[model samples]
Structures are given as structure tokens and as C-alpha cells.
Target: MNVAVSNNTTQPAPRVIKHRAWGRFKRNKMAVVGLVIMVALILLALFAPLIATHDPAEQDLLQRLKPPSKEHWFGTDDLGRDLFSRVLYGARVSLSVGIFSVLFNVIIGVIVGSIAGYYGGKTDSILMRFVDMMLAFPQFFLLIAVVTLFKPSLFNIIVVFVVFGWMGKSRLLRGQIMSVKNREYVDAARTIGMSDFRIIFVHILPNAIAPVIVSATLQMGGMILSESTLSFLGLGIQPPFASWGNILQSAQNLTVMTKAPWVPIIPGFMIFLTIMCFNFIGDGLRNAFDSR
Candidate 1:
């Protein structure tokens, strides 16, 4: 009877990785806006076939050079293709190139960087020097040079982008891993006789991956721009395929630039919008991951 009643209090649950990251991300207003716009663009691209009123590649010489109107929301291009439909389809190409190229670049970079960083001395020296050698080349020049050597198709262009893009990310993750490899948890894992692979992949990478995530997000816009640049130069995503860059290729003509300004403006704005949104989201992720 004298034992008295015990107090009952609920403990707060731990925050999830995604929830925590999202909480931090939403704090940035510009990032939230960027996320919204990015999602909308992605959806627009995904549903282009259904949303598009006309065939993106179908040409009608009679409708060519028409300005924005009820019949054609973005009007018609020089080929008399519906600009609105082409723009939507272009989003799929540009976005896919950006995403796939960046993904492969990050995977290769992370693997190379992790191996070099975890196993130091000669391994680090050789790998870091190789990265430096790759970096010494002017990236754009190198990109153009390599791209010119291959067939100008979507797959070839992505492969070329991946080849050049990994160097920076490798250097970034290598530095991050070096900083993190000596931490106490890593030492603890080592003390327990954990395999080198597990220690690096499981213990070390989770902590070091923040910078890589930020780097990858920031690089997306650049990747998209690079793809666009190549397409503009006729070195990527050949004709009949809609891409923001190839769409803008029309503006190279003075007549088209003067008479059908919408041809370039629409794609140009799309590129600008996509890049800014990616940058905003990158900044948000950087802030979100920053514990300070």
C-alpha cells in the first residue's frame, strides 16, 4: 500500500533519416518552391504522351512559324512540329540524360574514392594522382573531344559524360572518406575485426556520403547543361529525338531567331528553369545535411 503509484510518461520517438532531412529541407523556402516546380516538370515529362495535343515529331509545313494560339499552345516550329508537344517530349530526354549520367558518375566516383581513401599510402597516391591527371584536362574541351570520337547518340553521350564527370566526385568523396576514416566508430569497427569492405561500405560510407549527395545534386544542373550544349553542337541526341538543346538548335538561324523567337525562348526558359530549380534543391540539401 505504501509503494505508491509509478509515473507513466511517453518518450519521444527518434527522428527518421528521411523525416529529418525533409524537415531541414522544407525550412528553405526557395528549395521548397524548387522542389514543387521540379516535381511538376517531371510529371509533365512523364505524361507527355497523354498531355500532348499533337505529335511531337509530326511536321506540318502549313502551320510552321505560327505564334502561340488556341490551336497550338506554344505554336509551331520551323518544321511545323507543335512546339508545345516537342517541349514536353524534350523534357524527358533532357531529364533522363541528367539523371542517368549523374547516377553512373556518382557510383563510379564513390567506389573509386572509397577504395583509395580507406586503403591509403601508395593506393591513395596513385589514385589521387590519376584523378589530378584527369582533372588537368579542361573538362569541356575533353568532353567535346571524346564526344566527337563517338556516335552522337543518347547512350554514347551519357557514357562520355560519365567518363569525364567522375573525376571531381572521386576527389570529393576521397577527401570526405579520408576525414571520416579515422573517426572513433570506424576504429571500433576495426577493433571488432570487421572486414575492410564492410567497414568502408557500411560504417564509413554512411557518414561520408553527405558531401557526395550534395555534390551529386549540385552537379545535376551542370549535367543537364552539358547534355544541352552537346545537342546544340550536334554531338548528342541526334535529330528526330526531342531534347531541350536540339530544340534550341533552331535559334542558330538568324531567320528563325528573328521570326520564330518562341522556338529558342521556350527551350531556353526550360533549361534555365530546370537549372535554377536543381541549384535551389542542391543548396537545400547542403543546408539540410549541415549539422552545424
Candidate 2:
């Protein structure tokens, strides 16, 4: 006291939200398993050549419709392409569609929703009404119409997905922003002369984004399924590109479906497993974000 000697005590570093979220996420066993499976699949996709036994697109009519064996692993498809290699490559295509499409959808949603929610006047009404109009339309039907009007190329398919996909996200983000805009920090940011953009983007969006993150994880699986459905219907990725959807299209043939079930079964199983894993991860994230 007399000396007033310095006692240099370092303050603890603040905990990051992601750190806490991860901690919560680790507590869920099923989610951890799903994460492991998801990572493995991604690795398979990344190192397709290294792991693959044969060319995915290489054809052998003699080997076609063969069931799983030690030599061929997953066996050959109707085109005599190695199912194992095709599955790995298909993972690459399917995941690419799911991830890239979501990126664009979220970006559009964030911009539109932030503008409408933060402004909250005639802008909000107009935007919300437009969202409602979109919501009234059947999304699958709309996607079909758009795809039918354009080529079934991968880029066009992704565009159709984005066009229909962003609407729900916009509505979600708008509601989140409306809830967060009236909060104390946002009001304080405004009072401190922060730009409207800064207040909206930095202060409001960050705080309200937990739900969006959960929604995005869940929607990724849905996106994959949609892409698969489109491909199966011959409205997505075309021949020469291996996707889970196109892979399953072999099952559309009654004889192939019944006689050579492996063609559809393997890809179908992969689709189901991937979607379940994604859903598990989504549930984990939701729980983590929702926890106090």
C-alpha cells in the first residue's frame, strides 16, 4: 500500500462464440459421429484418383451390372464404369452443388433481408409481400419451370436452385434482424454515429446469425437432395458427369432396378447417409446456438 507497487495481473482473454459453440457441439455424440463421416466423405471426394481403383467414366460392357466384389469393390454401373470411382467423383459434384449454391443463396438473402429489416417501413412491407408471393408458389414446380426454360447444365441448375432457395432465407434473416435491431447494442451503435451499414452488418447481423447458421447446415442436405432429384429427372447434371442423382437414374429402369439393385442402392444409401449426417450436424449446431 505504501509503495503502491505494481501487481501486473493480465486480464483473461474473452471467450470466442465459436469456441463455446464447438464445446457444445462436442457434447453431442451423434453429431461427432456425423462430423467424422462427413469428413471422410469429403476426403474421398478430394483424393478420388488416389483412392479410386479405375477411371470413373471408363466403360466396359462386359463388366456392366456386376455386383460388389473384391476386384471391383462397389462393382460396375450399367455403363460398366467403376461404381466406386464414380461414387467418389459423384461426391465431389454433389457437394460442390450443395456448397456453392448455398453460398450465393445466403449472400443474396443477407443483403435483401438486412435492407428490409433494418429500414423497417414501406421497404419492409414491400419486401415481405414479395417474399409472401414467392412463398405462395410451389418451390419444386418453380425450379422445374426455370430449369425447363433453360439448359440442364450444372450452372443453370445451380441458378435455379438459388432463385428458389433465397426466399426462405430472406424471410428468416429479416425476422432475425427485426428481433435484433431493437436490442441495446444496436441502439448504442446508432447513438455512437456508426454508419447504418456498419450498425446493420457488424452489430445486428452477427448477433442474429446463429439461427441462420443452423438453417444453412440443414438446407445443405436439402440442396443435395434437390440436386439429386433434378439430376434423376434429367434436369440437372448431364451425362459424362457423375452425381448421386444421375447414378440413381439407373434404377429408373424396372429391369435394372429389380435385377441389378446395387446400381441404385449404393448411391441411394450414400444420399440418405449424407443427409442424415447433415441433419445431425444441424441439430447439434442449433442446440449449441440456442444454449445460454
Candidate 3:
């Protein structure tokens, strides 16, 4: 009897497995670095005003294209606005777009995916087909059309991103739900007369959302990239509102590029570094959640 009990107890509990996953995540040095970078950027964005020595929009043409120095650590742009200040303000735009757009994507995705996947058959066919059609469209042209139709602003950029972004997330979560909904525990939950909502969210979502979390994290970086691209194209938030892309736009002038190379370099570095950090964290999550 004692031997049989010991054999049966050998399997680890779910919480124990999760704790082990966290331990594994901590063991990855790159993940820790990414987390630190993410936190630091968040702090910088939140404290932009406090950290910036000058107003981001307060440009002085007289001091335009100045090199990096004590008075202007990141130098001045062609308009004479403080580059460091603009970069900090830009962080606010980038992080806001990334975070809120992902939030909208995840929420709408989880709901749509859960419904289609759990109900399956006609519902699944219709929704997945819609997702496919949306994905098939050339997104760049769509963005251009939409941005042109409306005045470009931070809110418009985020809204446009969320409108296009949720399709991918919905498809991802639908696949996860399809795989998870057939599990024995899920069947048991259904067998017990649990409400559909309870079965889908309470039981299945907890088990299935790990991948979605990682996807959202990675997507946040993509959102930042999109904002930068849009802003670079002059179809995003207009001037007077500094973002990384428009900040770099100053470098288009040969005088600014040569006289104050810092015009583009600093913001470019921030974008590169932020994307890398998000990718590192996504990789860490992938490794940590591997069932094997």
C-alpha cells in the first residue's frame, strides 16, 4: 500500500511545475537583462518631464544642429528643440502605443478566439476565414489609406494598429483554445454542467493564455516599430508632438546629419534596444513554457 502511494505521488503538482518554470526563467541571464531594460524604459517614459532639461517642443533655430554638450546632452535639432527632451517625450508615445494597443488586441482576441474555438464548426469556419482574409490584405496600403483619410495623431495611430492587430492574436488564441478545449479536464468541466463561460475562461484560459501573453509581449514591440514607421512616413503624429521617428526626421537635412549626427542616432538606438529587449523576453517565455 505504501509503495503504491509513493509511486502515484511521484508526479509533480501543477503549481510545483509553474514554480519550476519561474526558476528556469530566472536562470536565463538574457531575460533578466530584458526585464531590467523594459522597467528602465517605463520609468524613463513616466518621468520624461522631470528628466528633461528643456521642453521637447521649445525649439531655438539659433541653436539648431548643435553637437552634444552639457547644455544639450543629446544636442539640438534643426528647430533647436532639445533632442534628449524629445527622446524622453517620444518614449511616452512609443510605450503608450505599445502597451495600450496590445491590451486592446489581447482582450478582443481572447474573447473572439475563445468563442470561435470552443463553439467550433460553422462559427469557427466563419471567424477563421475572416481572419485569413484580413491577413491576406497588404497591411501597408491599408494603413496609408486609413492614415490619409483621417488626421494622424497618437490616438489614431493606436486605433489603427489595434484594428489590424487583433486578427493575428485571435487566430493565435483560437489555435491554442482548440488544442486546450479537448483536454480531459475540460471535458470533465463540461461533464459537471459548468457554464460555457466558466469552462472557457476559468479552466481553459488559465491553461492556454501562456502563449498569448508571450505573443502580446512580442507584439508590443511590433507596435512600436509600426508607430516609428508611420511617423517616419509623415503619416503619423505630426510635428510639435515629438516621437522617435519624427525626431530622426531631422537628420534628413544634410546639415543636421553632419553637424549633429545625434539627430537620428539616439532615437534609432532606443528603438533598436527596445525591440531587442522585447524579443529576448519573448524567447525566455518560450523556453520557460516548453512542455517538454
List per-prediction Cα lDDT, in the order shown.
0.87, 0.84, 0.86
In terms of TM-score, how similar is model 3 to the real structure?
0.93
Residue-level lDDT tens digits of model 1 in 1-292 = 1111111111111245557777999999999999999999999999999999999989999998899999899988888999999899999999988889899999999999998999989999999999999888898988888889877888888888898889888888998999988866677668769999999998778777878888888899999999999899988777788899999986688888999999899999999999999999999999987766
lDDT (Cα, tens digit) per residue for candidate 3, span 1-292:
5433543464344577678778878888998899899999999999998999999999698998888899999988888888989999999999999999999999999998999989999999998898888899888789889998999999988898888888877888898999878866776667668999999988788777878888998988998998888888888878899999887775788877777778889999999999999998988887787767
Q: Provide the lowest-lDDT 10-residue window in model 2.
A: 4-13
| Sort order, lDDT high to low | 1, 3, 2
Error (Å) of candidate 2 at residue 256 is 2.5
Where does model 1 exceed 4 Å of error?
1-18
List the candidate 2 regions with Cα displacement exceeding 4 Å.
Answer: 1-15
Per-prediction backbone clash count: 0, 0, 0
* Candidate 2 residue pairs that clash: none
Which candidate number would show the highest TM-score if scored against the true structure?
Answer: 3
Cα lDDT of model 2 by residue, 1-292, tens digit: 3112211122111246678788999999999999899999999988987998988888999997888898789988877888998899899988878888888888888888999989999999998899889889999988988888888887887888788888778889999999878765566667668999998887678767778778888998999999999989988887788899999986688877877888899999999999999999999999887746
